[model samples]
Target: MPLSDKHPTVKRRRSQLLNHFLAFFVFAVIVVPVNFFTTPDHVWFFWPLVGWMGPLALHTAYAMGLFDRRD
Candidate 1:
């Protein structure tokens, strides 16, 4: 069965999914290593914390309109 456009949540979820994928790809391949190397060794916990939280945090903000663009 095909998804109907009548459900607003479906559209929101679809948008969220696209944002999540884009966020994951950008952070995983580009941002992770840069932070891993440049960060100080004393803050070892920061790396994993940032690595996991960054994408979720950013995406959540975007979806919530906190980090949205006007253009």
Candidate 2:
């Protein structure tokens, strides 16, 4: 069953997810240039981005009720 978006729990969950996404974006902005300048040949920023994004994607899906049971 898809939870109504107006539900308090769902609203809070999405709000928190938004905050996490913002933080991740900020982190990437800071890390990418630093990683590139510090280690020009050994670029490694993608690793962290992939690692965090996978779980965030899952969280987003969950918040969207993709995994919820049908009633």
Candidate 3:
């Protein structure tokens, strides 16, 4: 049997993925360059990158059901 596309979980996952993509795109396009010129001496981009990556990683794990409590 084919899976139902209208399922709530499926819809939530789709929206979450789209949001993640948009956030990453905005950070790459705008934040990176701005940080590059604002402080030419040090590469401060890593600060934001490291900050965002932590949460992003957790979000990925949760979305993949890795953190689901299996009883």
User: Which candidate number maximizes lDDT?
Assistant: 2
Question: Which tens-of-lDDT digit does each residue in 1-71 have in candidate 2?
Answer: 55677999899989988998998999999999999899989989999999999989998988887887786
Sum up the clashes in candidate 3: 0
Give per-residue CA lDDT, model 1, range 11-60, as digits (tens): 79558868777866676676556656777554454465467676677766
Candidate 1 wrongly placed segments (more than 4 Å): 1-6, 32-71
Worst 10 residues of 2 by lDDT: 1-10
Model 1 pairs whose backbones collide: none
Question: Comparing candidate 1 with candidate 2, which one achieves the higher TM-score?
Answer: 2
Task: Choose the strongest candidate by TM-score.
Answer: 2
Name the better of 2 and 3 by lDDT.
2
What TM-score fits each model?
Answer: 0.38, 0.85, 0.72
Which is the better candidate, 2 or 3, if ranked by TM-score?
2
Record all residue pairs in model 2 with backbone atoms less than 3 Å apart, i.e. clashing.
1-69
- The number of clashing residue pairs in each candidate reads 0, 1, 0
